[model samples]
Target: MKINVVKGTRDLGPKETARFQEIIDKLDSISYFYCFTEVTLPIIEHAQLYKRSVGETSDIVRKEMYAFEDKGKRLLVLRPEFTASIVRTFVNNKIHALIDLPFKVHYHGPIFRYERPQAGRYRQFYQYGVESIGVNSPLIDAEVITYGYAALSFIGIENVILKINTLGDDDSRNKYREIISEYFQKHIHKMCHDCNERLQTNPLRILDCKIPSDQEIIKKAPKIHDYLSLASRERFNEVTKLLDQSDIPFEIDQTLVRGLDYYSEIVFEYHYYSDEGKTLGALGAGGHYSHLVKELGGPDLPGVGLSFGVDRLVEVLKEIEEDDNEEDYNSFVLFYLIPVGDVKIEDVYDVLMELRKQGGYSYDMYHEKKPLKTLIQKAKKRDARFLIFIGEDELKNNTLTIKNMKTEEQMVVNRQDAKQVIRSLFFSSMREG
Candidate 1:
């Protein structure tokens, strides 16, 4: 018998894992700059959590959720997305009562869904997102959008177009839903079976359908902007106005209702195109929700959030990096020590301890009794900036021989002053860079 990874999931080896970490680190830094505290949520929750927050009409609850009954015969589910769970955490912990209004939080973790894997998509994929709970303002909405845009920019993902739409307030959304329902009902017979099902539940989801045949009818359907209430329209104008003041480019996509039911106003997606001009769709998306916290048995607190498909972002970034010939900074070795000629580990243990004490540097040593040529080759593969040779002559002289791999320069320095010399060299390289 043989064992293999389950379908729709795969392992991330060294390189991929490093890339994932690098991305997470960048996101974490940006989130911190924006004053977002990090929080970890459980992967499992009651099945009703998603159903109540995400809505049973959405595809995630209806089809994609990894739902099962626990040993207690109580229904449980792997979280399909983060917002619902985050809201549950907020309510259950009473964070809103403890913290100030608009409690901001950021999170990154694995999300489970049972959909067929596609390009840049997985049934078990990671998500990076932020939630601003307890407040609902146009400025906060714009700020969340700007934060996501800034995060992607900091991650080196270029040419992202912000596609935005307004779902309006509850009353406006209800009115539009009723109007769109009538329009889709007239053509429901000609639409896909899923679209027919959506018509009975959420008519806005019909706009999210990808079937080519259904698109023509969907395009002909009523636009939400036409029915937006005065307040909803003003709120949207304020958001767009703030974005304009920030000089962030965007497009008003009236057709983009997003896939979730919790979204009520100002939904947006960050879209990107490949080098070949093929659309990769949304790298990330989010929107404002008015009733989720209240619906989850908490106070009537509105919130806004955004989430990036980290798996898709990683794949897209790999392609872009390959084209740009980006450097692998993760594998860079600041100092690589190679013991030349019959050098025992015990002989140079003190020097190794000194290097370890030099807190800000990354160094490694070759302990195997291999040829000097082989050792140098290994150092080159690790992209060592400086090569340190430890042998009998240097040990006797109480000196260290250092070679700059980039400049091909060599120098011998007193072991006591080696740290100073290396620090100078490192700073020089930084200045040059």
Candidate 2:
């Protein structure tokens, strides 16, 4: 019997895995450019970590998280997001007192959420993100958001628009929440059940509802800007100003109340637009969370963060890569080995290893002998630029036949110099780059 993969999960085949790795490599390089160090976090955490940081009313906590009691009778959850886990780490390790200020770290891993899966979404998904703690400056908020934009740009994603908003500080939020509550109360009966509950609980969430009718009602609701305290408004304006000075384009979106409860002050999301008119939801989002660290048992340090949906970003990257000019992905392989006639592959294994030691991307077939036509087809399929044939004749003659798949040119060289020629080709490509 064949065992099928779970409904919302998949095994990425070889090519797809390579493609994902390529995207991640680009992101890592960009992270270095932004001076964000790397950190790792566990996938499982005490359930309270999220409930406290994400809030009980948020959809992730109330309806989506995969929480269960372990054999120890302790409640644990497969992390639905990274911010809380990272914060917990920060607190438990006493990273605040031990490390320098503004401890910025980037992480990449899988996150689980028991939700209805759709295109570019799954119950188990991957995320890449950064958290900057111990700093409350609007400048840091702008900095992290710009880093996110730059990372996507480096990956060749096009037509990306940054949508930003301000949730204001605590006092500003309280005043705005009261106004929002009062406005939504009158239409409580007409709104969806979730929206009505949110009205009395966290009315800010109503703006995020997907129901068309509810969205229409939310549009007329009071905007956060109307109630932002002087300090809150100024802080927000400064963030936008910094982004503008940095030449990062963005627009203020007052209704963009991110779903997470920990976020406040400057909130931003990255949206990618395809020329084909396909809409891939927010590629990534983040905002200031001045109270989360304190609330989660850490020192009263201000923090801001953002996470990109790796699955969604990969989808976007694939689309962009597909539409790009073919020349962008030149078909070239470092080396491909073929065994001709009755010659055993074992006889040529040492040569293959030598090529690998020289840092060439070399591959060989399992079969000891195969038809030249079949071997040539395999070479073409793998995009092998240099094809080397191993046969009794060449082995005895101490000579090698190298074929350039690109130009269909062939050359014979002494067997001992094959590695040198291969290294030369590799170095030539590097020099051209």
Candidate 3:
């Protein structure tokens, strides 16, 4: 068999990779505006970490986790989601004990899934996520949702819809799970395999079933908000009030149970129209899971957060790329130095080093070993804006010839003055991020 990339993976060259970076960068910028510093958790953790936190019965841990045993026979798993790992970090480090109130932070990196690949879905993908822990206030829940919307909007994902729902508080959710299992007890055989599994494992997840028959039946089942305890209902109302004051539009989607079972109290999803803004799919999603910190062995503090599907976001951007018929906006100013012969190559090398030392220029193929005409053509192909000719005449006179590729204007200057000319084109350190 011929060698190639793995089945559900992709090799992103410069252009595609840059696009990916830009999207992530924009998200980080938006997140920073909302007081989210960055945090990094490991890719692999003990298998029990996810099993306990995300629930062993949920599709993520049950069917999708890429779990294996290390040399020590310890069960290790590539993280399927960020929240579990984030909480594990917080608990392990006793971060809650150190920080005051809500510990706001964000994470950005690859996430693994073993599901069959399709449009807007990939086996190996990336998630740029944020998590706020330690606070159980309703405003914190609303803050989590609104900040997610802000990240998407900052990236120009205009067609996103905010789907809001509550899983009741921790206590009320246990009751709702019980009611659903009892209500759908006899209908098990008629339900889809996933639903049947979810029924026993996480009954609330059954409400998210895609089976046409079961969906109709599940819709009439009990709404989770009805079961919310006094504290739970009041917390949900406070979250809604903050959302209203912030003027972020949302819809109450009772059936919007997350794939993982850790979410509680307040939950929501940000759905976006894919490809040419047509059908709906999740570009990003997140919500509150108040009990996760406690379950992960942390203090009795609540947590809430969201993560964006970078693969889907890229897929949507690809559609826009094709529609606009444009590639990445990359402008490379190739500085080509003309060389007369190998004898003068050392001088050209020195010039290249000097340009790089100035901190804003990149040059290639300018040695005297390469012909001047050949290097000039290479620079042209790269859309170079400035052509610097360093040849035998310049070496003797100690002058430099600078050609502006844009205006085709040529100027001859002393060696020191040439540095000043190039410096004017690129900004200094103060202007950089």
Work out the TM-score per prediction.
0.90, 0.92, 0.91
State the local distance difference test value for candidate 3. Answer: 0.79
In angstroms, the error of model 3 at 354 is 2.1
Q: What is candidate 1's lDDT per residue for 276-345, written digit by digit as tens?
A: 8866679999999999999999999999999999988887887887745344444667888888788787
lDDT of 2 at 56: 91
**Model 3, which residues run further than 4 Å from truth?**
274-277, 321-334, 340-346, 366-373, 427-433
Clash pairs detected, candidate 1: none
lDDT of 2 by residue, 1-433 (tens): 9999998998886566666788788989988998899998888988999899999989899999999999999999998999988888888889988877888899999999988889899999999999899977888888898899899889888699999999998999999899889899888788899887788679999888889988788889989998999999899889888999998999888889999999988899999888977877899999889888999888899999999988898788778767341322324456788877888778778667766675646555545456878878877776666788878888899887877666667778887787787677657655644
Against the true structure, candidate 2 reaches a TM-score of 0.92
**TM-score-based ranking:** 2, 3, 1
Per-candidate Cα lDDT values, in order, are 0.90, 0.84, 0.79
**Counting only residues 3 or more apart in sequence or on different chains, how many pairs clash (N, Cα, C under 3 Å) in candidate 3?**
0
Better of 1 and 2 by TM-score: 2
List, residue by residue over 344-366, the lDDT tens digit for candidate 3: 67778887777677665776544
How many clashes show up per model? Answer: 0, 0, 0
Best candidate, lDDT: 1
Looking at model 3, residue 6 earns an lDDT score of: 82
RMSD of each: 2.8, 3.1, 3.2
Which segments of candidate 2 are over 4 A away from where they belong? 321-333, 427-433
The collision pairs in model 2 are none
